[model samples]
Target: MSTNRQLVSVDYEIFGNVQGVCFRMYTEDHGKKLGVVGWVMNTREGSVKGQVQGPADKVDEMKQWLRTTGSPSSRIDRAEFSNQRDVPDLELRGFSTRYH
Candidate 1:
């Protein structure tokens, strides 16, 4: 067992009308506001994908935001998350929007 499993990481993809609607922008803002570290980018397949790492509660809040609320002009069909695990420390620093 390890200590400080309080940190967790997760990968997420938001589907439907996400692109071209500033989804990444809002995600970045919300992530930063939540004090989570990760990156969000627009996928080639027309979805938004990213990784988030932080305290479990913060991550959960981010997940909820990703699932239910996005940009004002965006319509979310669903959100899919994967690769969830507890980490001893955060692997990333600060939240931002990835260009690539």
Candidate 2:
């Protein structure tokens, strides 16, 4: 379906108080709800890294949620968004949390 409305993908890295806060679970749930596909995992540097692909609007909304209201207990200091690009189709089937 190569419609005029192209989907977008963004890579983000979250910092601060994310590790023991169920951030990945919450992110998965949110991504599923938003119909975005990508993978999220905890980095060795104590940060959350993932890529989200979906409708441009929804992706933007997800970014907002990730940066502002991540899991109930997460205190997100900042969300760095990068590699934003347009995609012809969804490369992911569903959102999932990756263990790393």
TM-score of 2: 0.93
For model 2, residues 1-58, the per-residue Cα lDDT tens digits are 5433679989999999999999999999999997788889999999999999998888
At residue 28, candidate 1 shows an lDDT of: 95
Error of 2 at 14 (Å): 0.3
TM-score of each: 0.93, 0.93
Off by over 4 Å in 1: 1-5
Q: Which digits, one per residue and each the tens of the lDDT, describe model 1 over residues 67-89? A: 99899999999999999998888
Q: Which 10 consecutive positions of candidate 1 have the poorest summed lDDT?
A: 1-10
Please count the clashing residue pairs in each candidate, in the order shown: 0, 0
Q: Per-residue lDDT for 87 in model 2?
A: 89
RMSD of each candidate?
2.3, 2.1
